[model samples]
Target: MKKHIIGTLLLGGWSLMMLTLLQSCDKQEVFSYESEHALFFERWKQVSLSERYRLDTVNYSFSHYVGVEDIEHQFKINLIGNLLEEDAEYKVIVVDSLTTATEDQYTIKNPVFRKGRSSDSLTVVVHKTPVLKDKSVHLTLRLVENENFGLGYMGYTDVRIRFNDMPTQPTWWTKEVELAFLGPYSYEKLETIVAANEGFTTFEGLSLTEKRKIALNTKEYISEHGITEKNGDPMEIPVY
Candidate 1:
């Protein structure tokens, strides 16, 4: 009876081990030939909006890379907004210029092992009904990895727009200030300005004379604009 019980336990353990190994092998096989690819898109800021009284035409330039070939991939675009609300109304038009190309010199329309490529350019127009007040709307584009036969990968981007007569201004003050202050300062110059600012200095002990000198210099610089000249230019002084 004891022998029989030992035999059964051994068999069960062996079966469990085999099953675990098989599962791991299957996962490895699935991802064995995986290739790295990425897709990205952004709205054109300069030409993104049209005149308030007219139809607004915009273009979104998309970029992507496929490391391998011979796989069929599908991309989908979705829009979400309150445009259909009782007080809001708008219409959208999308145009696709289907152009395909490979990153390599191999001009094969259809690739097998690691060949195949394509590019797309889309032109979109958003028309606001005269009755609708100007308002902001959000648009989202999603690229699903529909097929994964060890070929290219996938990614996506979502964009937001305001459909009103006036453009929406960004509410983040720090970003605006940073941009204004650093507009003329190179990274290196900004570093130097920060280092020269006494407020940024930390010492274990500051002598009375040293503190007086610092205070005098700060006052003189603020009153006579000496700091701006010493720093090379007002543009070189970082606001932060």
Candidate 2:
């Protein structure tokens, strides 16, 4: 009777093992030759499989980089299907209707997936034109189907990049900066302060006394010369 029970247990275990193997085989992916030649854009830093991993648009502000003529901005293009042993050139073109930047304002590098690699960097050279100081421009890049590659994910086939040199209010302009130092924030005021104060970019790590002195000097300067904001409002600084 014991031998009979042992035999039955062994038979059941063997059957379960075979079922698990079959299930794994079913779940395995089978890629056709045509399906292995697709590409898409995704953020290289994201490790998640969620939809957020797909990259659609990116924004850059040349305001952060003062005196920089141009910069090379790069984003990742990933392979959806298979890695190749030989280099594969991909086609990307700017959508003229969606692009506001002039031809000389930017340059797109030739996109190519290097040999034995599944991804490559698509670089664009963005120039800091005078127009960007007051306004922003968009550069939209779309992937075109070529002999070597096809578009991968539907929504991630293209990316829009908007760049500007316009300076916005810094985060360090807290309530303290408003009530105790500068009364109100203005782009013109900030520009004036940055111009007058050498090597002063942000108010992030200044002492209270130093801030008070700078505020007093700026207030005097504005009062003496009558510097107004772009909206014609009087630039005022609180005195305490």
Candidate 3:
């Protein structure tokens, strides 16, 4: 009887151990393991088209987070379009500059894609730059395609730029200027219009409504002076 009891206890212990091992295996398969340094794609913000022409700038800004200690990030820009023929020519101007108002202070390290590729697509490799922690960098990209594809489709097709992490800053601007040329005529134009006006020197202590009215009147004054022109052209504008 003593031998039978010992044998039964050993069998039950073995059964419990097997069950625990099976549960562990099942949990491992259900969970996905990802590295701490993986990067992701963020949404792109479209800037104003009028600003593009006025400031001669056109681009979009995007950002993603990296959680690794030290790892190289890799990314690519992919363009997709059926309208681009094999012989069509295109240009991509990638300007790497600091986001400041100092005139032409940024450097253009990579001016790529002057001619279209033999295929209907092109890809540009983006490597990591030296950047500080918790701060974001900006990359200005201009896609100029020389072809006639109607009003809306004149430029590059299916445009998207990708970014990867680097240890250093690529290039950026310290300060930027906002030009509100149409502030006086628009309903939402604010007090800043007075500052932007060429004829005004000081609007020290004006109310919000007073400032808006002044801006509207300034718009009329400029129109009477023939300082503005209107065209139905549609273009891409850059917004900060």
Candidate 4:
């Protein structure tokens, strides 16, 4: 990743000055400004595009990560600049195309954004039921036209997400590992390991370092037992 421009700007990026400035400015400069966030009708929030997600098998909970930037605070750099308070709501519409109906309404864990804070976000949690195991789910959440935030980045006002818990090989899982030990990508192998080993839980539960440890540990497993897969076809983790 590139380092942002040193100092001065809160973040290294260009801002458009289409609207008139709220305060006095130099000949060609806008001294202060604020963006209003708005979500158009049926606009899907740009979350993740068909990304793989993991479930906490121990608790049956799912978490979708999203971020909110302090665009207003970043503009308040001048001596007379001011930042306005903003709010974000967890407005979601379930796609009726799924085989099962999603009724979990505990969307936003903390929906309020108090003043003075640079930025904040809703936890945006999803609770899974036993019925979801066999159904495909699609969720679109938009930060609609709320009085709190009126302006936002285009194509980012809302996020459309499809949820899945299958433990497929992630990007970090290398082809080298696949050739040497694990077959291809096996959800069944992942399930077997987690069910047998108390230490091996959800893939998300492990830290980056811990996940790395599992990679080498898996190599050891393959060396001792020969290459293996719980399910036929496609590579996967070796289960005990």
Best TM-score among the predictions, by candidate number: 2
Provide the TM-score for each candidate, comma-separated: 0.21, 0.56, 0.22, 0.46
1 or 2: which has the higher TM-score? 2
> For residues 131-222, could you state the per-residue lDDT of candidate 2 as single tens digits?
98889999999888888987775556678888888886666788878898887777777766765566566677898888887787777788
Model 1 Cα RMSD, 1 decimal: 20.2
The 0-to-1 C-alpha lDDT of every candidate, in the order given, reads 0.31, 0.77, 0.34, 0.39
Global CA lDDT of candidate 4, please? 0.39
lDDT per residue as tens, model 3, 45-77? 336754322122222222221222222221222
- Model 4: ten consecutive residues of lowest lDDT: 69-78
RMSD of 3: 22.0
Name model 2 segments beyond 4 Å from true.
Answer: 1-35, 43-54, 170-240
Model 4's number of clashes is 13
Each candidate structure's count of clashing pairs: 2, 0, 23, 13
Badly placed stretches (over 4 Å) of model 4 are 1-81, 84-101, 165-171, 180-183, 195-212, 215-240
| lDDT for 94 (candidate 3) | 49
Best-matching candidate per lDDT: 2
Which candidate model has the greater lDDT, 1 or 2?
2
Q: 123 in model 1: Cα distance from truth in Å?
A: 3.3
Q: After superposition, how far is residue 3 of candidate 4 from its true place, in Å?
A: 40
Model 2 worst lDDT window (10 residues): 27-36
